[model samples]
Target: MVFHLFGLRALEVWLYSRLIRSPIFHQMVGRVHRRVEQIRHGIPPEESRTKLEGSGSLDKFVRYFKEEIQDQMKGKPRNKL
Candidate 1:
């Protein structure tokens, strides 16, 4: 039973790793992120859709992820107990 559980966990991890590594997955995540941001900024849904549709380049996607990571790191308190 323990071995079976471990095998299942390993398989889950492998599947998640592959999914995360896929470019299509990144593109989908990027789209969702942009949509959320636009909504948060009070952009109308139609306008947001148009803006998102115009900005799906690979370079923009990479830069977006990089900026998101930097923004996240900036918000953390440096010295946790």
Candidate 2:
């Protein structure tokens, strides 16, 4: 639930950026996604890969939720220094 909230927040922010015509915001969103992919691949944390083998929507949602939350929290806000 928390993770979904985080991803939803990010999606909202990105949509807002698109409305505002900010290329920078789009770039920020891309960076966030890349970080999530890196985490899932265990680039730094070195987590073992698990194969779910064609799971349901809930399974996909949970994994995506976790990755989005982790990525967003670690990312720097666009207006920050």
Candidate 3:
């Protein structure tokens, strides 16, 4: 049975909110978050060596990755990932 918003009770909302905040939910979310981050990023470095960002963190990473790839293709010889 679906409970419409207008007819929902306080107890229902309270229970739902509690379940959302539970540690189990957080752990599942953390796993998904890490997997997604790894996919978007090539791999997790042992230690990140980065300077302070000025509003273009993702753009900088993308550009640097692309440049490194292009340099390798041109036989410039860079770090092997």
lDDT for each candidate structure: 0.80, 0.76, 0.79
Estimate, for each residue in 7-69, the C-alpha lDDT of model 2 and write its tens digit. Answer: 999999998877779877777887788789888886664443565557686688799778777
TM-scores for all predictions: 0.52, 0.29, 0.39
The most accurate candidate by lDDT is 1
Show pairs that collide, candidate 1: none
Residue-level lDDT of model 1, residues 30-81, one tens digit each, is 8898799878998765544335444467678889778777777899534423
Distance from true location, Cα of 28 in model 2, Å: 0.4
> Whole-model lDDT for model 3 versus the true structure?
0.79
The order of the candidates by lDDT, greatest first, is 1, 3, 2
Over 1-81, each residue of candidate 3 has an lDDT whose tens digit, in order, gives 356654577678898899898999998997888778888996773443576466588788789989998998999967766
TM-score of 3: 0.39
Model 1: residues with Cα > 4 Å off, grouped in runs = 44-81
Let me know the TM-score candidate 1 reaches against the reference structure: 0.52
Error of 3 at 25 (Å): 0.1
Better of 1 and 3 by lDDT: 1
User: In each prediction, how many residue pairs overlap at the backbone (N, C-alpha, C within less than 3 A)?
Assistant: 0, 0, 0
Off by over 4 Å in 2: 1-20, 43-81
